[model samples]
Target: MLEQVSLFVHSMWELLVSKHSEGLYNSVCLAVLLVLPLLLLLLSVCLCCQGCCGRTCCCSSCRRQQHNRARRKKHDDLWISSQPQPIMMESLTLSV
Candidate 1:
């Protein structure tokens, strides 16, 4: 087991060294290392803003919906009240 572990570590080290010798791998690693923190920072800021502003954003939509509902209710009430009542007809006589 010890020998196997050492062999695995050696192989991994060799692979890393070979990739690093290519130059591109190192640059890629450097770019990822640099960009990763910036990305994480941006993500944290976005999450913080969302947590802080979520309620306010939701409240704005809620207020708009409430306003629309109130307007719709008012319009509906007016429309219904404006309709004339149906007159009752005692009978309809048709003479041929």
Candidate 2:
């Protein structure tokens, strides 16, 4: 069954590629011509902005660092809050 399925797929691929090679080639060329300049422009814009942020060349990296710092701070705050308070325990013992 697997062999049959593989053979079927291969035959279909061969039929489409061999029969429509000219049309497929033309469409691929046209798509490349249309998309190449836009891709280049996007890359240029990214390169231009890469150095705009102070102390960091890449914007995404700076943002990631800030996010990580904030997350660590939050985790540290939670850990500190979860620990038992010595002063509160001493006060309770004195009241008792």
Candidate 3:
């Protein structure tokens, strides 16, 4: 009867220890699975950040103002150099 008791106790102890070790291993695996993707995403952002926003020619407000001025100049030149001025048509269209 004592032997049986000892065996039962030993079997229960083994089962508890095995469950504890298995839980620890599973936690480690889950942590790695969750953390690996975040680490990879961070690494990708760090590597590609320069390519996205580093070398655009639109750097300053002054450059933008100059570009807008140039664009307006081109549009004005096309309109002004056309065959008829718009003012003449406006005067002809209305005679109240």
What TM-score would you give candidate 3 relative to the actual structure? Answer: 0.32
- lDDT of each candidate versus the true structure: 0.82, 0.76, 0.77
Candidate 1 residues lying further than 4 Å off, grouped into runs, are 1-22, 58-61, 66-96
Error in Å for residue 94 of model 2 = 71
Clashing pairs in 3: none
The window of 10 residues in a row where model 3 has the poorest summed lDDT is 78-87
TM-score of each: 0.40, 0.34, 0.32
Q: What is the TM-score of candidate 1?
A: 0.40
Backbone clashes, candidate 3: 0
Residue 57 accuracy (lDDT) in model 3? 51
Q: Across residues 1-96, which tens digit of lDDT does each residue of candidate 1 receive?
A: 999999999997787777678899785896697699999999999999999986575567788988899999977775455668786676656679
Per-prediction CA RMSD (Å): 12.3, 15.2, 15.8
lDDT per residue for candidate 3 within 1-96, as digits (tens), equals 999999999997786666668898866776687699999999999879877866565769868878899999977774445476456665566558
